[model samples]
Target: MEHEEEEDRLSNLPKIILHNILSRLPKKDGARTSVLSKAWEETWYTFPILYFSDGLFVGTFPQPWEGFLRKRKNFIDYVKRTLLRFYDNGLAIKQFKLSVNNFELHYMSKDVDHWLKLASECGVELLELCLPDGPDQDEEGRGECYVLPNGVIEVKSLTELVLMGGIRVDTAFMNHSIKFFSLKVLSLWAVLSRDEHAIEHLISCCPLIEHITLKCCSVLIPNVATNFLLESDTSGVMKSLNMHGLLKLKTVDVQGIQEVYIDAPCLEKFCYCPGDFDAPFKIDFDRCQNLKYLDLLSLKSSIITDKWFLELFSKFPFLESLKLNNCRMFERINISSVQLKVLELSNCSNLKEVNIDAPNLLSCVFYGGGGSEPIISFLRSSSQLEVDLQIPIDYLDLCNLRESLQNIKPQNVLSSLSLFIFQPTEDALNPLVFQVSSPPPSIKHLHLRSVPKNEILFSSVVNIILSSCCPATISLSFNPFFCTKAFIEFLYETLMERKEDGCFCGSGDTRCWWHGLKDVKVTSSMKIDENVDFKTMLELLGFGEEISFTLEV
Candidate 1:
């Protein structure tokens, strides 16, 4: 009796419990369990979620065309047989995902349409279709794309719909009435539409959509004689996206659109990237008062002025995170907010000064450009605030780096600094004796990354960083093709040879802080015993891509 009890506990589980276990596994893995036992096989056939993709046979084909044809036929036959079995058994499909390349869709569009119709009839709640573009095309210079079937749109059980790449929402959709009554999340990426109104009409019908993403979508509008249509044209791109009265909407990300106007009061996050920077760009979300995150990119300096920031904070009182990228700003800008916590600025090259006064700000990231670093001042800030500075690769000079360190108002507030350095054409790496005038800042960590052509450049970069700041920890990541063994050996030997009374530059200047170093620890993926020799440590690091040195002073 005891042996029988422990024989097969999994097969004795209830059917509902066994089905739940199979639902969490990959489709291939779930199918592999059919040979386990008769009870497990019965549970596998009743799995409600089905996902089919041509990606599984991508690299399996050794001979290009001959192997691809065999893989294609197998994939199609498998999908048809599985769906027919579920249909014959009267089982419900909760979710269905199909991904195929452009080459496969050209010959199997009708098969895809049949599968989608069956999924709709079986009440699929979540449906995702990904058809990426390929090099093959027809005589009209247009790639083959699958037109979305009307039967799929009429499904009242769908709660999430994601369609990406090589899919067309054509005039048939515009003429038919959409009935996506239960959709809550809708994402359309790189989809083509016949006219601008087709996409807008689709969005207006989905009243319950909470999260929406429209990116890289193009609209081909016919030439109309009316002035209203011509005035609103955005060339070949979507002219404008207007979302109003979406009460349940919370998140929206839109890219490659000329103008955007949203009036959703419950919106919490919004990210927008304009299609054309030279043309006039207009964005207004005046009614979204509860927004917490906003990211804008590529806006001109004439649009975002000092007064524009003042109006922005006043409009959205609850915003906590803000990111700006490649958006030109005026000479001076001021950011004063009480609810802001995270701020990031990237390649805003025109600005010369920035004044921040956020008492709750936790972190700020600044990426320097080719010009001089901006003067950053914190009038009022949190006591635990941290700052990150990223120096550009082209501006990686000792003088420029030192000037950046001195510009911070309260220099001790900097928590981390990253340097992207390369070897200079001039002979700045020559062994010359230089003296230190003052001690470097107290940085908690310093990260150095390079793709240098040789080991001499790597050594020079490390020497320049040590002279800049005295970080407690130094992390280095470099090209793997370089002499890793030699670099590690050089680093280990130099750190162990430094004496408490010796100076790095050999200038007899005791002011250098490294003279007081007590110990150095090197860390990598492989473990190193404290009793390990120098050669053993180098051997361990030969296979590691990144290594860190922790200094004890």
Candidate 2:
């Protein structure tokens, strides 16, 4: 009689709380709980996320992995019991993950279709079906796309979907009656484009999609990105997308794509790059109002001129961060991003000068592809309203920077600087001439690539920086010639002593910008700089590296 009363109390526990507990346990173990009695029998089915690995089930089965999985689901009565209980719980599933590798091909796609259909019927929101290996039997010379039935694609709530390596994947589902699918993220891999209209048909049906990522899928120029439109009359929101390795793509018809408008009011970031520079393409996001971040590998403007830059910025009113890399024909860059903060220009072949005018600018770096002369000229000519400038030491101005040091117009703000000093020229010409022109008011990081000549030996160069910028912490680039133990020790002690003198050690309220350089980062390419490690610099900077600092949102 006491036992009966205890069972009654267990049965009366809140269903929602019990469901959470069972969902957290291994599916197989959770199934065993159903055997506790009839009341527990119906609890397993309520578990929303079912993680069943075929390798896991093989341990309980009498036969090997393939034979066990090929058999009926009920053959392993425990797993069957778990699923039965899971189904009886009447809980809508949010995510379903099947962790199985080398899935036995002895089982046909029909078998997979059955289980996935069960998940579809249960309304799983995220279906991550991953088959890392392709089928062992090589029938088709090329990979084949899936020929899915109409019933499987009908899951209305599924927003995130990943399909990689199983059958060939052709997105014919694009032309299907796609309904109730407000899918936000879609990742497709190894899919070919034999059909002429495959890409266009697939994207047209996605009524509400924000992001698209394509990787490892090699194809011809059949599906061009320029053909898609963001029409002024249309009401659609697609904000973020990543397209990589569409190798042969030759052109993008921006005029046609302009008609298919963006519906995402909050769209901020986009990454799209034509694999080749000469690959015919056109990019026009004129209608996209709220775009903030753009990572364009190659902007194939017919001619890159000053007028073209102004027109591009005119389209993107709120553009902040712009990255231009590997563009050979791009000679002059005139950027007028009103809200721009971080500008990273790397490996622009013909890039001669940069004209940047932004009030709230924080950081700027130019990794000139062996073209330091043109960059230095721009640094000297640009407006010096006390902005933080990081240049290859060959380019800095010594005298002018030192004069403006103490009472910077934006008095409280610290204009942090980073220098990459090239080996001094063979003549009396010191690349340090640039340093004399623009003395860094509050230099934080100094990365020296090649040591200056004996005339401007390492110590004298260090003295010049200490006199000009007064950095709180410093990082010297590691090189075979200058990377000796004795030199590092002397440098460390000198920086520590100077830091104690209260030069760059503190600049009140300037923490907003220079804080990222709290200690110092001495990035090396190949060899080890065993002499002065980053930890040694952190010790001098007075901040323990172990404590983590969190940024307030």
Per-model RMSD to reference: 4.4, 12.0
Q: What is the C-alpha lDDT of each candidate?
A: 0.77, 0.49
Model 1 stretches with alpha carbons more than 4 Å out:
1-7, 10-45, 58-66, 134-136, 139-143, 175-177, 221-235, 426-435, 481-489, 500-510, 525-545
Against the true structure, whose TM-score is highest? 1
| Index of the highest-lDDT prediction | 1
Clashes of each: 0, 41
Worst 10-residue lDDT window, candidate 1? 226-235
- Candidate 2 residue 224 Cα shift, in angstroms, is 23
Provide the global lDDT of candidate 2 against the true structure: 0.49
Model 2 compared with the native: what TM-score? 0.55
Clashing pairs in 1: none
